[model samples]
Target: MASLNVYSALVVLFFTRAAAMATKENDQIIKDNNCETKMGLPCVLEAFTSIFKTGTISSKCCGELVGFGKVCHTTLVKRTLENPLFKDLSPARIIVKSIQTWNICLALIDSPSPSA
Candidate 1:
């Protein structure tokens, strides 16, 4: 029983350290890529809502998000999922939504605009 408890504790400690290290690495990536400054606050909020809830992203915001780059977008989403406020959310579902949002934004940015 004591050995089992020790094993469980060790497993918990290992995961905690790993999660911390991942978060630190993600923060560095965000900083190096200037992820925070890439998009305006309103667009960022729109992207967040589009991924975290049932919402749509505007063409302008989609352009901002596409310009934000996939690496930065993915890192930001992963970091946001680490927040306690989103604890109840399903990571898998959120990730799928994030990918969907990125794809939609990418398509929007790549598509040609109508001529006047």
Candidate 2:
């Protein structure tokens, strides 16, 4: 579990390609799009950190990691745009590309790619 977390971050830093780059700039042109409404990713992370007890996976975390839970691979990339910290993030291409890239990277390492 410990190893997975670090690898996950590294995967985020590695992916340089993603299909989402095509129209990512003009994709979701929502003017007042707010993220608080979709803060599920952070909530999922906090939930894991709270349940990650020591080197062993807590039953709580395991339950969330297994079936019915999507946190095992999915990271909060879409939530970044709403985050005030990364709101002004430039090169929307890189941000959007990284999100899709990490998602695929995580899918490859955590599970099979979407039957590509």
Candidate 3:
């Protein structure tokens, strides 16, 4: 029983360290890419809501999100999933949503707008 407890503790420690490393790497990627400033606050909120909840992203926000670049978008989503507040959320589902959101935004941005 004691050995089992020790092994469990070691496993927990390893995961903790791995999570910390992942967070640090994510932070570095965000910083390096200047991701925080890529989109306006409203657009960020729209993107977050679109991915994390039942919300639609406006065409304007979709343009901004597409400009934000896929690297930044993906890294930010992954970081958010790592947060304990989102612990109950399914990572697979969230990832799928994120991809869908990206694709939708990309399509919206790529399509030619109608002339007045």
TM-score of each candidate?
0.97, 0.24, 0.95
Candidate 3 lDDT tens digits, 22-51: 999999999999999999999999999999
- For TM-score, the strongest prediction is 1
User: Residues 1-116, candidate 1, lDDT per residue (tens digit)?
Assistant: 99999999999999999999999999999999999899999999999999999999999999999999999999999999988899999999999999999999999899999999
Task: Score candidate 1 by TM-score against the native.
Answer: 0.97
For model 2, the stretches where C-alpha displacement exceeds 4 angstroms are 1-75, 103-116
Ranking by TM-score: 1, 3, 2
Clash pairs detected, candidate 3: none
Judging by TM-score, tell me the better candidate of 1 and 3.
1
Q: Give the TM-score of candidate 3.
A: 0.95
lDDT of 1: 0.96
Model 3: weakest 10-residue lDDT segment is 104-113
Model 2 C-alpha lDDT per residue in residues 1-116, reported as the tens digit of each score:
99999999877766522434422432343223432233355444643343222123333333433332233223334434434565565536545454443443335456643665
Which 10 residues in a row give candidate 1 its minimum summed lDDT?
78-87
Cα lDDT of all candidates, in order? 0.96, 0.41, 0.96
